[model samples]
Target: MGEEMNKDVTIDTPYITLGQLLKEEAVVGTGGQAKWYLREHTVSVNSEPDDRRGRKLYDGDTVQVPEVGTFTIRSK
Candidate 1:
């Protein structure tokens, strides 16, 4: 990915779910689609592959979605 593909997502809560993050970033059309989306795509959390929709993402976590971009979670 290019420099433009790096994005920071801010959250107010302690953590955000993988599904919610995808929806917030417009990666998926709806929250329900996160499950299927994960199955079809490769998502790396902190350099490790993770496909759990309910995966809790906290501040400083890095998520990489091939073809989409890299997401860094930030606390607000």
Candidate 2:
């Protein structure tokens, strides 16, 4: 709804789905909720709103929003 706070999570891989990342990072309250957010919330890649939750998040891809916080794809 407002300016998204910067949040961080460590990813073990380069490619990950939004749904999986949500669960893995415990971002969404529930799996079903993640789906709903995917539809309602405007997820951004680098800065633009990205609706494709199924899109693979690779290196340097940043998912940001007011509720979900900021998730950066990292190497571990």
Candidate 3:
């Protein structure tokens, strides 16, 4: 498969949770799905494997989901 494109996710807050990011990006329908989503999908934060729904992502952080795409956190 081709390399995934990096998409920017702008946030006004200091940080956003993994669940919130997934919801905002429309990857999952509801925040409650984050738990199951994490279990079924692979998520990495800054290249490190992370499966926590509450993982705090700050500006400049990178989230990569192999089945989906890469997302970069940006502050607005």
Among the numbered candidates, top TM-score falls to: 1
Off by over 4 Å in 2: 1-5
Of the pair 1 and 2, which is ahead by lDDT?
Answer: 1
Q: Estimate, for each residue in 1-76, the C-alpha lDDT of model 1 and write its tens digit.
A: 5443889999999999999999999999887899999999989999999999999999999999888889999999
Candidate ranking (TM-score, best to worst): 1, 3, 2
Pairs of residues at least 3 apart in sequence or in different chains that clash in candidate 3: none
lDDT of 2 at 71: 83
- lDDT accuracy of residue 3 in candidate 2: 66
Candidate 2 weakest lDDT stretch, 10 residues = 1-10
Model 1 regions lying over 4 Å from their true place: 1-4
Give the Cα error of residue 58 in candidate 2, in Å. Answer: 0.9
lDDT of each: 0.94, 0.74, 0.93
Best by lDDT: 1
Q: Clashes in each model (backbone N, CA, C under 3 Å)?
A: 0, 0, 0
lDDT of 3 by residue, 1-76 (tens): 7776779999999999999999998889998898899998889999999999999999999999886899999999
Q: Could you tell me the lDDT of residue 27 within candidate 3? A: 84
